[model samples]
Target: MTLLSALFRNQEEVMTFHSRVKLSAYDRDLGLFIVANRDDKPSIKPLRPYQMLVLTTKVKVSDTRKWVEEVFKYRGNTELLQQFMEWEIPKFPVSGHMLKENGVPGGKRIGLVLNKLKEHWADSDFTASSEDLLKQIPTVLSELDIPITR
Candidate 1:
């Protein structure tokens, strides 16, 4: 018999193998890390690209969420927080990935960096030009000890 038949002696085994293969494929294609525990067995889930980057930068996931919440609390604007959650936060992973790809520094204190960005954006009278915003990026990066690339 083939490798599949050799590995799965019965119909039940064959089904289980197929199910696992499908789940693994789905996870790989979608950039998702989902875990399901079955039959008292531990499930292993690999880290996603962005998650790995975050870990490498030594940023705690809880700290990031706390910073987001603190900014929301400081502003006391539900609508603005909603917009940030709906729009900006989702883009963070993609942005992080791009920065990593470009050899940009990943600072250890990502929470502080995020808080600064939030403060800049939250200012009611703040009207920074695109160039001004770009300049601020390097400043934040420097504060985080992330090397500035030309």
Candidate 2:
């Protein structure tokens, strides 16, 4: 069965994706508008290719209303989901439980490499997604209260 079918197998197992699309208006017929007039007349420049992004995911429909709600969970925005679609399902990131605190880099790409190393070192019984280990990361971060500046 398809992945979508699998995700929605039972209502209990289903994860809802509340997708939102915003498209800009473009006048396709405006061929002459491209010709720069010597008069320097202001013309409506067509918008670039419309951005297609999924705004949010929700277990309950109302969760999409405010993204910052305490318990709200979401999977991706448009760019994130687009990249996720391209990712190979077989390749899952490793949890960095086994690594030293110094091992995780300040950058995301380095962190990914560190995760790959963790995956390689994982034992037979150890699933890469150990919840106990995952929980520790945030706990440690919270203790440090590291400011994440965009």
Candidate 3:
């Protein structure tokens, strides 16, 4: 059976659908999903795990924007904060429970947290190397007011 079928075999309703089945590969390492059925060829798709989570969970865009502004106040760099919010934040695998614990009532809160983490890792030195920044992820999360537990 194809990957998608194998993954959803127990979902009778989904399995019975008559439309052409689409195949997508989820990359755990990258936290991304690649759609393979487009034009009968596999292509890199911009499906992030957090995007899926956000879709299933209700998120208020206004709240998210407000959180972004709050994060900007803490981080103090509009350009970097915006980039971090748009790109890095969505890559984080966040759950409803985690969001609630972190005072992130919606996607905006999550974005704020992510931006905070990014800023924390930067340690007031925006020129930090990539390797150094990556190593600080866990520490930054732990130090945050609302810790992120795996």
Candidate 4:
């Protein structure tokens, strides 16, 4: 909520998808964005769960209704948003407990490792299993340059 509120820097009564600000926050955040020309022609891309975590992190829960309405209204197509409404990202198969048992130190490191694993999971289109993600722990940790106390 605070993220979204602080993001739209324009002084509008209601925050809109238009990039009134210099940066296109949606494209950076959700991989979805809109472009408008002087002719009032707008090209708006529908939302996608590129990073499953980003849906909640970037898009404000309270503004979901308004956000969906605005985007769909422009698109004149409701199917994608409908799918987004029904679709639920599966729970990550790997857990912090599993990481700990495998020698990952607790605290912020656990979250970093998990987030890296989740990136792999998302890359696999959310099909990676617990074992699959767990196998990548060492690689992910190395990529993150965390010391291998494991």
TM-score of each: 0.27, 0.18, 0.22, 0.56
Model 2 lDDT on a 0 to 1 scale: 0.29
Expressed as tens digits, the lDDT of each residue in 53-127 for candidate 3 is: 332333454444333334333334466345436753323333345544544445554565555544443333334
lDDT of 2 by residue, 18-136 (tens): 12222121111111111111112222421100110012122222322122111111221345334434533232334444333433336553354443333332332234464444444
Q: Give candidate 1's TM-score.
A: 0.27
Candidate 1, after superposition: displacement of residue 108 in Å? Answer: 3.6
Clashes of 1: 0
| Best of the two (2, 3) by lDDT | 3
Candidate 1 has an lDDT of 0.40
The digit string of per-residue lDDT tens for model 4 on 1-150 reads 223433444434123543454435543332132211001222243343323434333457434434443444455556755765666657778888999988788889998898788778877777989999888988988888886556
User: Which 10 consecutive residues of model 3 have the lowest summed lDDT?
Assistant: 29-38
Q: What is the lDDT of residue 119 in candidate 4?
A: 72
Where is model 1 poorest over a 10-residue stretch in terms of lDDT?
Answer: 30-39
Q: What is the C-alpha lDDT of each candidate?
A: 0.40, 0.29, 0.38, 0.56
Off by over 4 Å in 1: 1-94, 98-103, 107-111, 124-132
lDDT per residue for candidate 1 within 65-117, as digits (tens), equals 43443334443546644654553322222244344444455564445555454
